[model samples]
Target: MTDATAGGPREVPPEQLHLLTEFVGRSRWFGGKGRPFQVVGVRRLGRLPACADDGPEVAIDLATVGFEDAQEGSGESGQDYYQLPLAFYTEPQDRLEHAFVGHFEDSDFGVRYVYDALHDRLAMGCWLRSFVDQPEGPLRFHRIPGHELDLDTHSTLFSGEQSNSSVAFGEDSLLKVFRRITPGANPDVSIHEVLTRAGSDHVAALFGWVDTPALRQEGQTEDQVLTLAMLQQFLRTASDGWDLALASIRNLYAEADLHADEVGGDFAGEAARLGEALASVHRTLAEEFPTEDRTADQLAELAEGMRRRLDAAVEVVEGLAPHADRVRGVFDALAGLDGVQVQQVHGDLHLGQTLRTVRGWKIVDFEGEPAKPLAERLLPDSPWRDVAGMLRSFDYAPHVVERSWGDDEGAQQRAYRATEWATRNKRAFLDAYVGRELTPAEQTLLDAYVADKAVYETVYETRNRPTWVGIPLEAVARIGES
Candidate 1:
């Protein structure tokens, strides 16, 4: 182990970087999975204020991984940046054995046992206290005007989150730490801050956010610093909408005499409520951001993009070959769309992204699609894209329940009932969103968006869940029908 001083930044020993690369590759949140990556550079972000001086010192770094060898011939692949928050100690942390990266010696700090620091309670206290104290220097903390943060509350790290780490403080507040570095803006924090100030009931209220002025990218503007974490009021009593939908499906399947609408766990009401919540959120986003009409050329370009994706998707997902032309027809009709309103929308809206509280539905995660580039996600798109996503989710809920029953005696009967539940909920949701009978032009637009989403899902399912490929494939068929 190498030696390091306290309260300062230092380079990680170059030889031990391979350990980090291995840890990253094995992680679920790491983007580059199938491809190999090498640590190209490391920039120390800042040290957290740890209470235990005798214990391990905590620090964070942004590590950039390059896929140069694998992508040598291909021009598209580039390096990815990962946020690494680590605790370094002279002795082993038995409690953090699961999160241990490796035993390494830093040049400035010798004989250190390194671990991912999010799991460390003392390391997390630095974040909670920062909101209350509003500390000076490179690490800056800012809060909304009125709310006072509870500095004494202990934080509980949310497990199994993919893109970011979140800590909930016993119904007081929740802190979402952005793991990947994006210099400009993260809509998840920025949008929630706006909604909370507006007194919107459909979202969690924002408390504060933490940023560091010192650790910025080389070419980024001087004013732009990384958005380290966001703090908002915790939805203590909130239940997941996806879980509720599954429960509703199960309730429907259990009843022999009752249809979906007649079942005890009828989800039509919840679906409509969710639609209203989404519509309210869309309105808020439209007011906060600019809303505009796409020119004829832009509409054609949008249609072309969908067609291009379908063309590419058919090559990989052989099941899509039959419906490719029909799906293309839906996209082709979008060329005639005129005066269509486009604005900032929940690009990845789905049942899983919503919560059903005692008051009503609360929509979260305005960050758009997790996989898309930040710039593309920020771009204005049709609100129908959000509608289509939710529609697909409604379809998925019942079918997943049907699958759980297996090829038993009542499988076919359950399949029919699943379709019934999905249809009722989808209709209820769409009616609430549009608030009127859809015109032919609106219907056509909706169809195209749904087709585009299904094509995207096909590609995803083909890669990740091959067995679940039937869901989107079936959607593509019926969606293209007259």
Candidate 2:
């Protein structure tokens, strides 16, 4: 165990370090699952202030994992930090058996049982109260001056998330605790802050955030900040956009004779609304943040990067080899464009990132792509990239549903209907977003972006879900043929 400061915060015992490593390995939010790593150090950042006497003591610990083999020139030290908020009790609680992390003997408190604090309502309540109170400590909680928090609500941890753990407090607020720790300002927090302050209705309003001084380590710079979590308004009556799309696909499939628009669950209307919401958010981001133009030469560099990625992808996804020439042609056309306008965009946008509520469509998770570095995720990109992601997601919706029905009868008919559904929704979304027919230049950019996204999906599906690899391959074939 290691100390974060020279004299502040206590260190975990050396014997207990393995418990943390095992715990992290079991967690869904831990990103370095497949990689070989060791929990080299643990440092207590601070304790959550203000808890009832009956409640367990809640403390935040930072665990540093060191990787044996580093990716050369990847700008990574091959090490990572994870935020662990633990609730310690004098005795093991039967109710928290599922959330238990092992027991350890403390210097001052003696033997204490630890559990993941986010799962403990009482511990989470302390967190919500601390955000409202903004007490003095190394863990600083900042709040925006709008909504009053309800202290009596219980926190329920969301199970759907992969990279971060989100706990919803009643139906009022949601706290997103980032598991993988990066030392700089998080784009998710910064982007939400801007949109929330601007009164943009497309995003959940940001209430506040949790942060502290960066955990200083060997070969790392000091004086930087680390954002641990963010508090935001919870959409109590919202439906996931991805779920809605799948339902629409299922609805279309049930009535084989009905056209996509004639079906009860036709999603073109909702798709149009989501497109408009994204456009509004993009406009807001472009106005609030900086905007720049990529010259023809820079666009050539972008096209070249796509080609390089395609080259690498071919090695992993052998099916991509046949479509390589056509995909390359699409990317090469991008370099012929005079210039393209760029702005701060949702680095990764898709049906899964959206929610439909009573008010309208709300986009969430502005943290960009999980695979990229924080700096790369924060870079300004053409809004077409987001548009392309959504378009590919539209393509994915019905195909994903169809893939679920393997080797079934009437497969050919379902394939035709699926194409019809995808085409209708994609057209509706694109038309609503641009408000007109796409010009030649615009078409070129959108086509290239869509092709690039499809290439990425091919690589992902090849590694994770081989059966679904055909979805992206089909899209690539269509793009190549066009």
Candidate 3:
């Protein structure tokens, strides 16, 4: 925990402080969970310079702390430091939106506070200074009437396991405040920059960004995600790909007595259309960007990495061994192929990462796997990795729904129907994708890519989410049997 104050600061009342601490712990945005946490300390960053008529001067800053016990209460821990950046607004009844108050209680001295470190003006100002000079470029700031600005400050939290905090503004603009900041230009910003420059309509438009020059810490550069605010034409009636798929699955299950082709709410059409959109996007990427032939060494490296991941997964779920071997065979077969095209691709593609609007299916978020190192995500790879990711997502929808509905007979029936729906749409999508005439080499490459993706999922699910691991394990088995 880095201190933002010049020197040490004072503390609040024990009851007020405890209320604040408890309030923070209950928040959905708060990352620290399953661990005992005490304030350890708090420092008021500074007053938010009175806006008008001597209103509340919002103070903000970081905090430092130590665990009560090293290894007993919270499983395991040492002197762990945390970045407890916060914003305190005195106009609790007026300025505070009380975003998550319904989810958590705040008693007396209940000043409205939000974990707004990501989009803090200071942070964004810092980030912006690095790329462009102040008062120019994409990082422009001006003082508007406080009342006018207040009306425009509508904040709604995005729902998902996000790597950062995002709040949409007026449906036309989006601000993605990165959580775990890295020094380099983030790929999400970088890729959107290219796509927008290329006049690509398939992706959200990139208006601009804010960044700051980082300080040199030890031998490394330290940069934070001040703010990556982008303006785009928001889809007014757009449905996320996950919702669309879930709806389709539910509809199909409801009409399971009818043939999928004859079903009223069939997803085949959407799937085919999405497939076409993806193909178009891929073609554009290939045309605008350079690609290279995947060398044997590169393939070997991928194989080794995949093997290690699979081995770890198998250790966790012994039931996965048979499926793992089959998935391995697919990779082994692909390794023999020559001249596979390698290019930059969406390293993490899934239903949640797409949107279906009046314009059609538009891919969103190009940040790649959040857990992977930046270098690995930026690396050029087979486009099939993306394809496999989508396919796996398709498989997850029904299984997830089934789990949600419980493991009763009714749930199994719904799962079965959903699987049928998924299979039908998957074929439809693949047909649209493969229908594009391709060289035999391209076909081989695509197959290998899909195999690699399934293997990746197998490892990921097994490690982080044991319950969902079976879905990818099943995919590996099916791919092998095929």
**TM-score of every candidate relative to the true structure:** 0.93, 0.96, 0.75
State the lDDT of candidate 1 residue by residue for 87-112, as single tens digits.
Answer: 88788889889889888876545778
Identify the superior model by TM-score, candidate 1 or candidate 2: 2
lDDT of each residue in 271-378, candidate 2, tens digit only:
999989999999999999988889999999999999999999999997788889988998999988876889889988999999999999999999998777788888
Instruction: Please provide, for model 3 over 239-339, each residue's C-alpha lDDT reduced to its tens digit, 9 standing for 90 to 100.
Output: 88888777766666677577567767777898888788777777777776678887777776766676676677677665777666676776676666666
| RMSD (Å) of each candidate, 1 decimal | 3.1, 2.3, 6.8
Best by TM-score: 2
Candidate 2 weakest ten by summed lDDT = 1-10
Looking at model 1, residue 269 earns an lDDT score of 88
Checking candidate 3 for backbone clashes, the offending pairs are 48-58, 126-212, 127-211, 127-212, 128-211, 128-212
lDDT of each: 0.81, 0.88, 0.58
Pick the winner on lDDT between candidates 2 and 3.
2
Model 3 scores a TM of 0.75
The numbered model that scores best in lDDT is: 2
With a 3 Å backbone cut-off (N, CA, C), the pairs that clash in candidate 2 are none
Ranking of all predicted structures according to lDDT, beginning with the best and ending with the worst: 2, 1, 3
